[model samples]
Target: MTEKLWVFDTTLRDGEQVPGCQLDTREKIIVAQALEALGVDVLEAGFPVSSPGDFKSVQEISKAVSNPTICALSRAVEKDIEVAADSLRFAKKGRIHTGIGVSGYHIQHKLRSTPEAVLERAVKAVTFAKNLVDEVEFYAEDAGRADKDYLAKIIEAVIKAGAKVVNIPDTTGYCLPVQYGALIRFLKENVSNIDQAIIATHCHNDLGLATANTLSGVENGARQVEVTMNGIGERAGNTSLEEVVMAIKCHSEIPVHTDIVTKKIYETSRIISKLMNMPIQPNKAIVGKNAFAHSSGIHQDGVLKFRENYEIIDPKDVGVEESSIVLTARSGRAALKHHLNLLGFPVEGEKLNEIYERFLELADTKRDIGRKELLSLIGEQMDHSLLVEIQDISYQGAEGKEANAEVTLEMGDKVLTGSSKGNGPVDAVIKSIKQLIEHKVILDEFLIQAMTKGSDDVCKVHMRIMHEGKPYYGFASETDIVLASARAFVDALNKLPIKATN
Candidate 1:
């Protein structure tokens, strides 16, 4: 039988510890509500004693979200536990997380206390917290490097002292998968009261083994996993929520499951990336830009034939609309035909062979082939009468005044003009263009890259729009950024599956 695994998210606590990624109280409340909607079992809001701002954020988040058990972080000190308990007074279900160093080095150097004294402090803290809150969790800081016998001894004491959960944190990320798994197993075997409390794993990514160690802990007996969105935290990072959730999903033998709404993972990742001002790495697993993009000739052919052949997880499962078959020099004829069919062009036999030869010649010169380049190959055989044409675009911007723009477009026999004002020239132009379209479109992403250095450098604009929950992409290159932005917007707009022209 599959067991229920609790997902404890520390994005607002440990994740916000990253430099320059701090969130205000309002932002913390927003993320807390989102985490509740994502079905997290526990949410570590913040350390209440750190600052007044953090205390307010934790208190406010407790009032905003109701599903997840709101948790507050603290040290073994009585004052810290009291403040943490106070912050969660508004929470429907609150947990006090208190801990002390367990490793030899931590007890000797960091805490400058003896092991017996540290154990006493740990039990005392948990006992005090249990009296203040219904649920109390005790963390053994640096348990990965701590002596297994001592770790088990302290954990048993905490559980006896009323801790409902015990956290085994690889604080320095110093343990390998085999070693960490053995550590959890040893505690289960040696600790007399271990069965009374849940075992939680909190692994760091210092050596890039956070996810590996976390999974190993689960394999042994951890019932809860502490994680952050995008693996973001102090130092290297923390275990990624997406990675852990997807890993258990892909492997059934693990015999555990989570309550995550997998389809909302991508959008949640985007929101965190945008709000934190941290860009998701292009190759990041699950939520990266190239996660579902295929460029190799063989890979593209395999994915086009059967998605399962090349992908274990469907893109739609993580909120992505579909996979992307990028056209590059390494692409094969199968990929070429796929794009050709998408553009409403059919070719076979001698005609296809003739076009393939020309495509190869051009592909060798260009790194990526886009729609314009493909159309150039089609030449007179393709119809351009119904294409959307940019007739005129004008915008004005100054220091303090709002930017204003006007746009005119020609589609077959129809001409439409629109005007608007915005925070910037590009925003104004996009707003004006939206007025001319009948369908509701939300600009999801916009990126600009400069190919050359200098005043006349050529810049490429890439835009993505969401219409009816599906994504449509556009691209344009020009020296004038405003003009390029308008062209790219129109390019995506033309691809919208709408029948009306006016």
Candidate 2:
């Protein structure tokens, strides 16, 4: 029988510690539901004693989530435990994870106490927590650097005090995999009554060894692993849940099993990234943009012939839609032909050469060329009809405390100029353009974001306009916000006639 490993997700508790990664109560609940669906055994909701907002988020998560054991982090203090219990009132299965520093550095410098006092506090905290909830976890903070003998004593005391699980965390991400594995093995061999409680490993990735350390702990006898999604946490980060889970499944020698639904990994990562407004690195593992992208010539040919020759894991297994054969400057004839055929354009011989030349020219100018651009190029080659609706003219903003804007419109042989004053300059420019075009389209949403970082940065504006109850989206970028907004508005207006009527 395969040994089952318990997955303890600390995205809510520890992952939220990263600066600027704050999530509101609703967003926390959304992520908690996703984690529950992903089959995490324990969800560390939050540290209730941290702040009122954290307490409320923990309370809400405990109430909203039912599948996983909702856990609240607390110090060994009585008041912290009370707050944790209150936050977990509605949870079907509640856990109190309480711990203190046991290392000599923390004892002498941080805690200013001796090993005996630290062990006493650890035992008392666990005993007190056990009385309130059936599940009580005790963490040996900085256990990686702690004296092996003293660490074993503390673990033994916590077990004696009724800790159902004991966690050995490399809090500072300071331990190598070999040393971390040795620590777990030492605890197993030296700590009396160690078998009574589950040994959990929580590793940090300061040296990029968190996942390796976690697997090493499992190999040495730890049955539970603490991790976070996207490897998000303070400083370096915690062990990535996706990386560890996938590693365990792929390594036959490990033979560890988890209840996680692997297919939901990409969606969950994307949802978190969007909610946090953190852009996923294109080269990030598993769920990144380039995870399933093939770029090399020999690799692409091998992948095209036999996918397994290049890919060890199928993209679909991780919820990725499919592998993409992107055409770039480094692309070959086969890739170019494949992309063209997929775009519903078939060309051969001299025509193919002409199209490929045009594609290379466009690709050189643009960072990325999409299917629509290829189709437009093909349409131009075929002499297809192109509609021209809006024509451009110059415009300027009025100078005053409450300034308006002036606009000019040239469509076909008609020339019209108008001026309007409303809420702001951009609004006035839009109103003046609308009057010239004579189109009454309802503006649904308008957003402006900086395209680059600087004092005088370019801005990109996205606009959604509704015409006849159908929505059309368009975007524009420029150094000036007013121009970007006007161009975005005009772009949306241009799509109106092409939009199919409902």
* lDDT on C-alpha atoms for all candidate structures: 0.89, 0.82
The TM-scores of all predictions, comma-separated, are 0.88, 0.79
List, residue by residue over 220-270, the lDDT tens digit for candidate 2.
999999999988887999999988998888888996799999998977887
* Top candidate (lDDT): 1
Clashing pairs in 1: none
**What would the per-residue lDDT of candidate 1 be over residues 228-261, giving only the tens digit for each residue?**
9889999999999999999999999998999999
Q: Of the candidates shown, which would achieve the greatest TM-score relative to the real structure? A: 1
Q: How does model 2 score by TM-score?
A: 0.79
Give the poorly placed runs of model 2, Cα more than 4 Å off: 346-362, 372-454, 459-477, 480-502
lDDT minimum window of 10 residues, candidate 1: 493-502
